[model samples]
Target: MRFTTPLSAITLMVASVKAAENPIIGLVDRITSISQDFDNALEDPNPVRIIETLPHLAYDGANLVATIVSDVTGWKNPLDNDDQLKTCATLKKFATTEEKLLTAILNDVVKVATLPLPIGGLIGLVASALKEAVDGIFGFSVKIAPVCSDAANKDKAALTDLIANIKTAI
Candidate 1:
């Protein structure tokens, strides 16, 4: 009976940790999805609605990323911290540049989104430009392949380490 009680308590604690981790993982998934969708939308000829929608989506995703980072750090509200504020400002600037590029791409798409004929050539040009713009702004390739790969595999380990660091701090 004594051993059972302690074992049950340990199980409960493990379950609690898993539960906490799930939300952070879900947030990461959501961010990745939004980013990929925005990237894919740039390749469509009629992309204005997506272009218009992307800023808010990206902002929401960023906010979620910040929240998860803060949570993993055990920081009550890292958004209010000076360093985090600076990071947010930087992210906002990059996001603005990305939006501008996407808007330009969408301009071409807007001309053909509803059209029956394919606009593959124009879309290809705009996608290339958009990729360049995003790379310039973010200092990384805008290829979804690398980004999604990192997000799926590398990010989990990184987040796990981050949480461990936070636990040590506490």
Candidate 2:
């Protein structure tokens, strides 16, 4: 096939279509759903379930931060894919915002979960309730590829800090 139109015109069209289907959109959707879940979980009057849930939630949040960082900063072939480059920037901005929001939710949940409780009766109840609640609210299905380096990427420092804060809060 010979180029009937300019080569750049075809390239732009293909890239725009690919950008519309970027996988980052799926990640953003998951993050949005989970963020809303975290908000809803916090509204529960019982603190035991929230206590059990935040640790797993924080673990999953770490995976998201790692993937978001890798997607934005790990591109070795940025020039070869305009759609990836464009979506990388968009995803980084959006994921960072959600990360902060989720961190705030975890922080508040941790505070409530830590409040002093009567020693005997509710303690056993808290333990039993937590075991059941873990599977209900804190599990995630997405398997984010681990970021290659444990060393801090300067570009992803904010996410790193948020992940750490979530861990601490939980």
Candidate 3:
């Protein structure tokens, strides 16, 4: 009975530790999933499918970015090397997806523009809005890449200044 009690307690402790995962990793993963969805939508040949996917992607992607940035600002502990690399890799994937999405949207705009004025115009507006959102996210990823990569390797001054600038911007 005594041995069984200790084993059960250890099991509970392990479960609790696993449950308390790093929030940033989860946020990055979610954003990455959104990014992949954007990629898949762009890859689809059906224009309707692409259009249908845009609103959800825009809303979710923007919110996720905001959430991640907010969480990062609040984080006090420095990430270990493994986590730092994982985060940077995911961010790179996200930026790449955004870049691809922007290019695809531009191509789609050219294709859709030949339609009659009203429908074409509406699509153009949606495309523009999506592009704007992608631009914001892409620009953020580009700006942060260096800072994120240098997180563990570099001195604190650069990262500190970046956080201060972000807080001011927010």
Candidate 4:
């Protein structure tokens, strides 16, 4: 009974750890973290500070895309990035062109985006997932149209052209 007790305890620990370490679960946590960071940055008075935060946010976002693609392809996320990193670079470039406007856009995004970063199938279901994840990260701003709505809503435009462009890059 003593031996069995220790073995059961170990098994429970391992199972709990495994459940917590599930990559999709990790992905969801990461989404919430980035959303909080972006929201906090938006509240700051300085937009340059916000710019500093954007790259890291974008990279994490890329990693999320990579993770999703990897889930589908069985390759490591590093290999099957689906251009998520490139999308980050593009965002950096876009920010450089107009920091003030981009900052406002990001603020709007933080204000309106739904969280937990959707993960629809990457191939045919790309639109829904990207609309929720990629678009949430990089689209839906005051400058862009439609603002925010339910991801599954058919009548409302969930993603702007910017959203589509970023999703394409990723």
The local distance difference test score of each candidate is 0.38, 0.43, 0.45, 0.37
Ranking by TM-score: 2, 3, 4, 1
Count: clashes, candidate 2 = 0
Tell me the tens digit of each residue's lDDT in model 4 across 38-143: 4454455665654455555555556656655554455233312433333333334333432333334444554423333221112113223333553333332111
The runs of at least 3 residues in candidate 4 whose Cα sits more than 4 Å from the true structure, single-residue gaps closed, are 1-23, 75-170
Name the candidate that leads on TM-score: 2
TM-score of 3: 0.43
Instruction: Give each model a TM-score.
Output: 0.31, 0.45, 0.43, 0.37
* Candidate 3 Cα misplacement greater than 4 A, ranges: 1-25, 32-53, 117-170
**Residue lDDT tens for model 2, 45-69:** 7767655554444454455555555
What lDDT is reached at residue 40 by model 2? 50
lDDT of 4 at 133: 51
Report the number of clashing residue pairs per model.
Answer: 2, 0, 0, 0
Against the hidden true structure, what lDDT does model 1 obtain?
0.38
Residue 33, candidate 1: Cα error in Å is 1.6
Most accurate candidate by lDDT = 3
Model 3 deviation from native, Cα RMSD in Å: 13.6
